[model samples]
Structures are given as C-alpha cells and as structure tokens.
Target: MLPQERQKEILKLLQEYRSMKINELSKQLNVTRETIRKDLYEMEDKGLIKKVHGGAILNKANSETNYDHRKYTNYIEKKSIAKKAAELVEDGDTIYIDYGTTALLFAKELMSKSDLTVITNSLPIANELVNYTDFQVVVIGGTIRKNEKSLFGPVANLGMEHLYVDSGFFGMGAISSEAGYTNFHMGESEVSRRMIKHSNKTVVIADFSKFNTVAMNKVASVDDVDVLITDENTNQEALKELESIRTRIVVAEIVEDEKSVE
Candidate 1:
C-alpha cells in the first residue's frame, strides 16, 4: 500500500482498537516495522495520534479545537464528568473553574447550588453562572483570548495571588504519569497552575480522551491534584498509572439520559 493509504489504514485500526503495538501494526499491514514507525511518527506530528512506548494510540479528540467543537466532541462524557465534579461542591463553597468546554459544563452543573462564589477565567462559565443571581461570579481579569473566550497573562496570575478557594476545578488537554497534567495553551495552563497553588484542594475534570496523552504546557503534577473526576470509559492502564501515583480517582458513571444533570 502507498504511504498515505497505509497511514489511513493505521488510523482506522487505531480507532477500532484505541491503541496498537508497532510490531502488531507491521504484521497487520504486511509492512516492515520501520515503515510502521515512520507512519506513526508522521501521524503524531499531525496531532492525529499519540505515539507511546512500543505503540501508537488513537487521539482524534485530543487535538486542540475551537470552543464549540470541543464542547460537543465528547458531550456525554463531559456531562458525566461535570456531574461527578459538581458532587464535590457544597452550596456555600468558594471554588475556581478554569477555561474549557468541560469546565463550562461543570459551571452549568452548579446551577442547583446556592451562594457559590465562583472565580474563573472562562467567559462562558462566568456568563453561564451570572444569570443565576444567587452565585457570585468573579472573572479573572487579564487579556482576553478572542475566539476561545478566556483570559490569561500576568494580570490574571496576579489576580489569583490574594484569593484562596476551597477547591479549584480545571480541564486538561492531556495527562500522563510522566507529564502529570498539561494543556495546549501556556497562558491558560499558568492560570490553572496559579489556581492550584492558591486553592486548598485541586480537582481535575477531564474525559477519557485526555488520559495518557501529553500536551504542550505543564499545569501541575498528579500529586498536586486532590481529586480527579473522569468518565468510566478511561482505560485500565491509565487508571493504574494514576493509582500508582495515589491520585484519588472518581469514575463518573455515564448515564445515558440527562435526568441527573438537569
């Protein structure tokens, strides 16, 4: 098969199996192991797959996309994660919600609570919670990112200095045993880092798609996170890594209906 055809086939297989060893891919495609390795490297460069030790894994939803695209990419999984994360909040809690679609969904999940003091850098989350009237929404003042509706930079970092929160919830682009927690945007990751530093407890809200992946910006280590809420679809290998680090994991059961969220 041509190189493009082989890459396409590899993507299809990864999508089907989620991940595959390089030798297995070579045998399956009747290609040399070196050819498989080259294809995997190129695919990883394009953000299509993540190359892991001895293997490559499907990573279609992990690429950085615009807000609307990400908001709907893993809708059900985000809902489940948001619901599970919301369970940790109390009516009078003071919390920090960072920028991202999952974080926005998490803000929505907090509508049931009363007297929440929510500090955030996400315009969507701030707007979503503001209408409720009972919650006090504080937007982290910083340079605004146009399309993504987020704020960051030194100003935002300075804003986090004087404030302390009961808990801080963040969405990550990727997480791994080695990288800990990372995201695509440096500014956003810095804000998350500050929030984590200032909060008493840090909670990471992410779906299974983010597991075992590494992104550009470092947020915090697994040890910094007090709780991690993810969907049940997360793989065992990834879960075991988090377990080995002694990270508290909450597997949010995926409810097919929105009854729980509503």
Candidate 2:
C-alpha cells in the first residue's frame, strides 16, 4: 500500500483500539516492520500518534468526528477518575477544568460540593456547575468550539492569565512517555497549558484508553503534572512508562454508589 494509505489505516485502527503493535500492523497492511516503524516516526513527529516500544497509539480524538462517540466510551472509568481527582480538591479550593469528556465527569462530581471556585472554558462544564450555585464558576472568555460546546483561543488564555488555582484538572486525547500529553485542539490545548502554567498543582484526568497514545498537539509532559488520576484498566507497562518520568499515578477505584462521591 502507499505510505499515506498505510498511515491512514494505522490511525483508524489506533483511534478505535487505542494502540497497535508494529508486527500486527505490518501484517495487516502487508508492509514490512521497517515501513511501519518509519510511518510511526513520521506520525509521531506530526503529533498524530505516540510510538511505543512495540507499537503506536493514536494521540488525540478526531475532535469533530469522535466527540460524541467518545463521550460515553469509558463512562465507569471516567467517573472513577473524576471522583479521585475531585478528592484532591478542598471545599473552598479554586480549580481549573477543561473541555474533555473525562473533565465533564469531573464537573459532575463537583456538583456535590458547595463551596468551590471552579474555572473552565467548557460550556458543558459551566452548565453542569449551574445547579450548585454555592460554587463560584468562572467561565473563560473565548471563541466557541461549536461541535464540542467549549471555548478556546487567545481571549480564553487571557482570562486564564488573571486567575491562579489550587489545582488544574485536565483531560487528554492521548498521553504516553514518547509524546507526553497530547490533544488535537490547539485552542483548547493553549487553555490547558495556561492552567498548567498558572496552577499551584496540575493534574491530568484520563482513562486507560488514553494512556499510550500521542495526539496532534502537546499540552505538557509528565514533569508538568503533579498527579495522574486514572482507572484500573491502565496496565502496568503504561504505568511504568508514566512513573519513569516521575508523574505520580493514582489508579482510581470504581465505586458503585454514586452518593459515595460526597
């Protein structure tokens, strides 16, 4: 197959399955291992995927294409992650949440709290916080990301500039040792990066599916975040890769009772 055809196939598989080994991809595409490796390298540099020891993982969601599909993809784990991340916040602490689906779950968990200073660029997150009028929600000013119902761009960053937070809760398109934390949306990425830059502590909230991938734009590295809140499906190998970089990993235990969030 042509190089573009092969790369396209590789990305399609990665987005669906998250990661694929070099040998498997080679066999499936009727290409040599060397060819697959080169393709991964090019894609990695483009921030489309993260090349691992034996495979590549898709880094970011297709954004426009998969936003809805991803919303319910890992509901249980997302809720678990969101809970664990919320535990890190004190009742009065100020926090930053982004537009990722996992972050939306985090927003839901925040609803149980009454005295929080929640700041975000996500319209969904803002709407979720509405029921808790006791919490102070700061919506960042920016252009709308219509398909995703979030805001991004320079005005958002400017809004972020004026505030500092105790914690910044973020979601990922993909994260791996090779690519760090990556995303497809530059405007959103910029907003998260600013939160990272300004927060007293930065935390990345993602499910296991995001562990080994690299997305189109980088948000930050393991060194940037103070904690990683994920779930049990995150394998040891992936944990080792993250731990190797010294990012503190917290594998959230899924609780059956929703009321337990309080």
Candidate 3:
C-alpha cells in the first residue's frame, strides 16, 4: 500500500480499538515492526495519533494527555481540579498517586515541593518525580498495562499492602450518584481500591465530565472518598446530592487567559 493509504488504514484501526500495539499492527497490516514504528512516528507528527511504548492510542482514551488525544476535552477544568488537589498536600508527606491523567497533573504540581514521599503505580508519575531530589518515589511493581502505562493485578496489590501513605490522590473514568466512582477497566479499579485502602485520606480528582457517567467497574463508593475536588462546571444538582451524602466537595474556578475575551 502507498504510505498515505497505509497511514489512513492504521488510523482507522486505532479508532476501532482505541489503541493498537506495534506487533499487532505489524501482523495485521502485513508489515515489519520498523515500518509500523515509522508509520507511528509520521502519524504522531501529523497529530493524528499518539505513540505509546509498544503501540499507538487514540487521543480520546484518557487524561494522561501524552499518548492520547483527550487533552483537548475539559482541559481548563482538569487543570483547575488538579491545582486544588495539589493544595491538599503538605511538605514532608507521603502520598499515593493513582494512574490517571488528572492524577498525573497532580504529580506535576507536587514536583516543585520539598521533602515528599510519593508512592505510585504509574510509570509516568514516577518518572515525573525523578528529578526532585528531596522527594522519594516508590513504584509498585506488577503486570504493566501497556495502554494506560499503569501496573496492576496481584503483584501490584501485594506490593501496596505493605506500604502506608498520608493521603491518596485518585481519578476515575466516571462518577455517578448510583455507582459512586467507576473505571473502564477492572484491573484499574482494583488498583484504585488498593490505593484508597493504603492511605489515610483519599481525595478524588475529576472534572465535570466525570459526573453522571458510568464505567464498567466500580472503584469505590462516594463514602470511600474523603474529598471530591472538581471544576465549577459540575452540575448543581449533582453537587447537592453529593453534599446530601455528606461528601466534602471542593469546586475549582476556571481562570481565563488575558488574551481570551472576558
């Protein structure tokens, strides 16, 4: 196939599965791994897709915003929520960070602080804290989920059992009055639950879009979370309901840039 045609086909596959591994693409497209890598690089240059370690993913999959196309959606809202969540962490505290895009943002905000112990199951989060000499980073080892860059399964949970943290910053695929907090994958749900169990306080970081949505697996109940930090765009009715359940909610306001219209 022509280069353009091959690239188009690859994008189509990515849209269908939301993600595709290099070897999987090679076998399906009847091409060499190097060729697939070149195609991925070209696609990334065009902003058509994102390249992960072993594969490329559709940008809309999740918030990490690195290998996904979802950065554009609720961008300001997520940043605000992340900022509010960051304020909850104090110097000389050990915190657990879950593997979610919003949680990654929280990690970034915490990087400038001094004397922190960060325990995480996210490779990206661990990498982000590597340059901060005063911060101690502990990565829970487990079976790696290539798509999300997170470690999960029995090994990860076992590792988490022995560690304790002052607080946990977690994000969810969806949150609803009925389901509480949910995730798209079962393994991710397990990791989130384990993080909550290991921490003294659990703060959930999410944007307005997460409210009223439901995912495949339940991570924790609303009661399980100590605080819910979200953006101002969240529905008032939902906020009222959360309050009725005695869930502490913090709404982060959006700050517009000076270049934008007031």
Candidate 4:
C-alpha cells in the first residue's frame, strides 16, 4: 500500500484497539517494523496519536472516541445484508441511513438506482452519494464528528422533522431482546432515535455479532423495528429469540456478491 493509505490503516487500528505494539502493527499491516515506525512517527507528528514505549495510543485531547466506520468482522455477511437491504428501497423512496459501516455499504449498493432520496447524518455516506446526480442527498446539519465522519446534536433532529422517511435503515452496536437496539456512541443513538420516529418502517441491518451484545446507549428495541436483516450464521437461539419478539426477520444469503468481486 502507499504511505498515505498505510498510515490511515494504522490510525484506524489505533482507534479501535487504543494501543498496539510495533510488532503487532507490523504483523497486521504486513510491513516491516521500520516502515511501521516511520508511519508511527508521522502520525505522532500530526498529533493523531501519541507514541509510547513500544506502541501508540489515540490522542486523548477529546473525551469521546471517534472511530472511523469501516468494514468489520463479518465482511461477507454484512455485504449480503447491505445488498438485500438495498432491495427494500424502491424507486423514488426517501430513506434515512445510519452512520454505521453496514449502512455505508448499503449506500454504495443504492448507486445503481436512478430515483431515490437519501437523508443521512453520516459524512461518509453523504460523500458516497454526493456525485451521483440521480440521488437527492440531504445531509443533515449538526455538530461535526470528525473521527466517525458523522453529524449529531439537535440540528440533526430538527431537519428530520421535515422528512417523511419511507424506511430508516440503521446499524447498531447491538440488538438484544432485553436492551432493544444499542449503539457504542451516545450521540449516534440520539440521531437514530430521530430517524426511527420519522420513518414509516425501521429496518436494522446487523450481523449476528450484534445479537445479545448491548452497547452503552440504547437506540430502540426489536419491538420498535419493522424488519431485522441478518446473516444465516447467526445462532438459531438468537433467531428464535427475534422470532419470539414478533419482529420481521429477513436472512440475507451469505454468498459473495458478484458485483463486489467484479
């Protein structure tokens, strides 16, 4: 990878793990330790991370952690879920997309659609659709979250009032029968609640990892959502629990999307 691209990956790892050894980073990045050290030096100079004895940690200037949303553990499953979720959006439908990694993938899937309105608080998601003339992209106004490339606060909610969303597709940290929907960040939870209120149908695009794992902030419960899109690898017990909640569960086939491979 290029120097710039490699550094970005380093930063993302630091953000997720908080700190990692030079050796570990080299192993993960598949680069020489000297190269990793040079990248770390550059990141330290930029104030993005602080170099410690053997590794680096995120700059603690801010209280909240802003992790960049990217492809995660369940790559194939999330891609399948995202592709299936895209089908739920018909022509000319206005949808509210969350600022989650899966939601970003779903936004990319919508690129082929010629007539659609997408309202989002995610800067990355908005950027994905910004150049597409066929998409009417409305990025909500709010306090900018630099790390996650998302928006939050009251203004984001105010904008949602004028929007009548056909569907609100969200990515949550966890979805439990008890806790409902939960997110890692409190600000994201606030934005999701507003989207859910404005949406006629609320759809949560999640991999099985989210099931039964509750995060810090609760977004909503299975009772509030209209559909749950997940992969087949999810445990039968978890699926049974969802069925008991009476939520419409849509299992996305876990085959690789040919479009992605192409």
Tell me the lDDT of candidate 3. Answer: 0.81
Highest lDDT model number:
1
lDDT of 4 by residue, 1-262 (tens): 9998897787667657888899999999999999999998987765456899988876653123335424655678888999999889898998899897888889999987878989999988998899999889999889887767889988887877788789999988776776678775557789898889889999999988777665545688778999999988887788788779899999998976544531
- lDDT for every model? 0.86, 0.82, 0.81, 0.81
Please list all clashing residue pairs in model 3, or write none if there are none: 59-68, 59-69, 59-70
**Residue 207, model 3, lDDT:** 91
Clashes of each: 0, 2, 3, 2
TM-score of 3: 0.73
Score every model by TM-score: 0.76, 0.76, 0.73, 0.72
Q: How close is candidate 4 to the true structure, as a TM-score?
A: 0.72
Error of 3 at 195 (Å): 1.4
For model 3, the superposed segments whose C-alpha errors exceed 4 Å read 1-67, 258-262
- What value of lDDT does candidate 2 attain over all alpha carbons? 0.82
With a 3 Å backbone cut-off (N, CA, C), the pairs that clash in candidate 4 are: 180-221, 181-220
